[model samples]
Target: MTDRTYIDIHVLHSVPPSNLNRDDAGSPKQAVYGGVRRARVSSQAWKRATRVAFTDELHLPAEQLGTRTKRISSLLARRIAARTGLDDVAAARLGTALLAQDLNIKAGKKETETAYLLFFGINQLDAIIDLIAERAEELAALADDALTKAVADLPVREQLTSGHPIDVALFGRMVADITSLNVDAATQVAHAISTHPVEIEFDYYTAVDDQKTAEEDAGAAMIGTVEFTSATLYRFATLGVHQLTANLGGDTNAALDATRAFLTAFVRSMPTGHQNTFAHRTLPSLVSFVVRDDQPVNLVSAFEKPVRSRNSGIAEESARRLAKELSRAASSWGVTPLAVASVYEPNSDQNTDTLAAFGVPHSLDEAIASVLQAVRGRLQEPA
Candidate 1:
């Protein structure tokens, strides 16, 4: 039988205490789920920002993820048709018709609608630019005040024109689905951390916009000035041992090394400014190391919390304590074949309290590097 072990890389967020109800603006300082109080993170606050950051990493277009496909699609289609000299009904029909047809189906059915809406929105934008340029001389011949209003109202009519805005209609729909943002509900994040794998390429437009968005908007009140432009992103995915092995002709060790190399390279090259967080977010607190051997099953440790929770010196103390505990687990079992798994989490009050809830007495001092080595030795010992 193949041996398997589960590991969790817990992230610790330093949150201040608060008194708030479920319906309040603030997140729950304490709330119970599955018969235990969970350390709550606000959906609207930093958590949403993190989700957006990861989403950015995934390189999936906003249309493929967010839930506001229909609205954004309508908006984009209207923008396009108004410039093209189409009426409201025609614009809506053009957008909706593209969504129902091949525009969405080509991107894969996973988030077709959202993708279609996004495509339409982007196309609409292009069409709007073209229309504005095409009509500039005509509009300029009229009064200046009249031209401004004419340009503003132009988008509402350009939605028709059969072939133009289809891509925006499709792509916008995709963004709405993935991001869960729609006209009816305000956008909110579900968690502080989320992980997903994707294939992405360098998108210069997205990069430029990201840099621009970070700047204070000096032209917010100005007419016909630069505005927020969603940037394109590139994604690099981390793989596990099994995934690595599968991709590398079934060589487990090579897979591990490949995974490690990829991760190391990606992390090393990540931009420093991208690391800033809105709420004093710390770097990743935990690192998981997987070990596998030909040992028998049913010898796993009952305790799962990898980090020690106590005072300032929790890491060293937790490492030492885990080393001792691991030795005991190995000795109790008559056979030891071969795996050592080490999990780490930052020593934090919430995490410590969580370990306590699990009936494990852990302190910060236990997380020393020496302790990890000692525990690894015991777990890897051959019988």
Candidate 2:
């Protein structure tokens, strides 16, 4: 059977004035779309928030995640030292040589760091520790040069590539030195853009000096300006069920579980830029999950012309536009989705007939369940 499973998640949420993501100029990011300035949040920012949500909210165990950093050698060294009876310094030297020879990753300016950030799973690191522990006596007797040749043929690539770390599977990993270790990302996240034109606003604020005496100049403070923008944003992301399952070593069950967590986190997570000051955590006004068999449909084109407020507000209008696009795409292409679940906070009565056409509204959790059920059924089919 043909693998026809793609989960398309669409979000319509309005946020207050915030610097969720900033540019080099210390201003909220913006992009010119439809010949107008639209507030933008980079995909990288949202993806990071989602990853954190996986640990904090979803409570996934550490084994399912990957660590991305340049100090991978130091981290592996600590584990190697604990697993084997080697000292910290010896473990560090052995870890570096093995990583370089087997994985082709070289150390940077210092011996403790890699040339760039390396993303590897906990299971992958454990495999390295196991290899070191197996040859503890032989490797411990040799110096740096001898140790390098002793374990030169160990199959580190094979051990690290499998057991796809949940993070590496979704976001992907790049190995320039050893291209075979690179993992293709199973999902695509689009930079969120506002549905309407926006102008950047500045908040001029001053911090008062509490200890300054009134006799010595009354005007004593430091002042600064912060740039920000508030708008109803249309955020979009898609997950390929086939690609994700394959990334997980063809484990359909794990793929389904990952999808549930990924969708929930993507919809619920909010980036924290000046969160202590602004605390701009807003839930999506409307969220829709569409399981399409043909291809992933991005409804961002609906807002390409830029929606305007008439009776309904920007968020409400944004929802209607998205629903209409979903209907238009299905009718024009004659391709019906496998399943769809949409949940909207009905604040405004202003909506197109297509909103109801999207299907009976379900709660957020219920929507995720519905999509996951469809995905599970599809994966069970003969492939």
Candidate 3:
């Protein structure tokens, strides 16, 4: 069997009355699992939230970042103008020419646009500008053939992978028309779901006009109902360490740093859906990490039957159920990870041993540090 490295993370977090993820109709997203409706948060929503955290919280450099947009021409145009001191129109023309040679753009369009949304790293953009700058004289000479030849020699893939953004490497990219530009996501995020059955709740609210007196305006100015739900959610994500390392061009140290930042951000980030209406910001009550050689395991099946909260809260009960399920699953599969670490709130009746039995228990900060050290040690060892 091929020995591949994988990192699995599981979290039990409780969100208060809020709509963390919503559908087109502005209702909380839901799915039927185990023959019952469960509150769900889409993978896309959580991934976007996590990516935002990488910038806002982790403070990663912009150079090691990717942008997702359909306005590729415009973005490149602005960058080219800034770098080359060219007029907007000239820069836009150059941008279109460069993108047309590399990307599979449409024909006869006044405004340059990709056929679909594109994810491009900052490094790639800079490389394109550098290539243009190297041939600035030729470009200014208005020699079409010379400019075409110069653009043709540009190495798109090399530039993209040289200083790849952690988010882009983890989440991946796809250029539909040009399959060569597609990148497979190194990380897989499962849709977060409640551990118990959930029913959508509605809040009817109204706003009164401040300018009009009660005598002038007897009725409310506007009124609406918002759909919401409260649940203790189970979130799971797995990262392919081997794939991540490869995506970063075999820089193991960068891989370890990226992994550490990802773990910290994932635990802290929260989706901001209707945040003004329902301010539901929370940290995971329990966080577990496992590094193993075997295939990644998701303990979500533990909640297939659903956990009912009795004396304790849903978060506590869900934690208990998850711990039990993980123990049984690991034993049955005859799987032992290279390292394991977990952080959990104290519970008198809960079986803390279920987790501590596998690996050391630690606080959130300690857990992150320990996991990173373990990963770094593993990478340091020779194959």
Candidate 4:
């Protein structure tokens, strides 16, 4: 068997004065790394952005992606009613009964809501709705307790177990009440942190009413202050090929496609927080893909001591540090990665020599293709 265990992606991207992610106080998030304050973008925010890119950039079908919401019961009830010729009221009652009895997922404070958000496949919902519709007449007439018990023995949970959505398989699902329904995530995304110390900056200004004259409105119609920061962030993510293939039901082709889509999402996606005001939609300057048989390695340690540049821009220096760190790590660990590919764009310009570890100059598309080629060769090798 091939010993490959993980595919790791490292990125160095720069964003202008923007709050790509914010805390409760409406200030940009910060993390003290290496004894210095660094601008931060939470992993959750980036993961959500990746999911959105699956639809917006890749245009994958609904069946390939899942929906996330707290009102899953209501959504399922509506679908069940539409497909089963049952009334909405009856569907609501029946939906809650079967879900509680068979799945053990109880309804929340709101009858049609769950205690937490559920991420599930679109096709999986249809399978469930159809399962309910199969015995709608009998199930609807039964008492709540009886309906719960009657459906408890059904194969409802199996529907959820099968046909895992790409996002669901990658990011995973947590069914608190029903542990059997949970899918282990195949990917790990690290929070993006600046490669240098950062200070939060504030933009304080006043807005004047356009229609009202200065004589009538005085100095201004409104006044406010906004917080933001700019930095070159070092981001990382790792994916387990084994876990992904298992989640995809041993379908290697599907796993490969998912891998490609994932690479695209992570490379291209951007968090949209305050995007309208700041428009902080910048691409990464350097991206490297590493496939390893050993454990995934993160290159964030390269920036443990913040990089400094004198008006030449920090991306080049940052890339130099990252490249050196990866080389040193591989040497120190005595574990060579199975394959590596990259596209470097220091100053938003692409090149091959920006990092010696990554050989040829490749566009983003070519880099993804390279990783996939390496993965397929390794996975398909004869044991």
Q: Top lDDT: which candidate number?
A: 4
lDDT string, candidate 4, 227-258, tens digits:
99999999999999878877888778888999
> Which of the two, 1 or 4, has more lDDT?
4
lDDT of each: 0.32, 0.86, 0.81, 0.86
Predicted model with the maximum TM-score: 2
**What TM value does model 2 have?**
0.96
lDDT of 1 by residue, 1-383 (tens): 11232111122222112221122422222323333333333333342343344345544344322332435555645654666566665554444433333223234344323334332334434544465545533554445455445555454333322222211111112234333311111111133211111111221221223344645664333233111111111111212233223323344343333333333322222222212221222333232222323232221122133232446443334344334443554567543323333334435543453332112332322322322333223322112
Q: Tens-digit lDDT track for model 2 on 19-47?
A: 89999989999999998999999999999
Worst 10 residues of 2 by lDDT: 345-354
Candidate 2: Cα lDDT at 154:
84
**lDDT score, residue 234, model 1?**
13
Work out candidate 1's RMSD over C-alphas: 18.5
Q: Which order, best to worst by lDDT?
A: 4, 2, 3, 1
TM-score for each candidate, following the candidate numbering: 0.32, 0.96, 0.93, 0.94
Q: How does candidate 2 score on lDDT?
A: 0.86
**Which residue pairs does candidate 3 place in steric collision?**
none
Off by over 4 Å in 4: 1-4, 143-146, 346-354, 380-383
Which pairs clash in the backbone of model 4?
none
Better of 3 and 4 by lDDT: 4
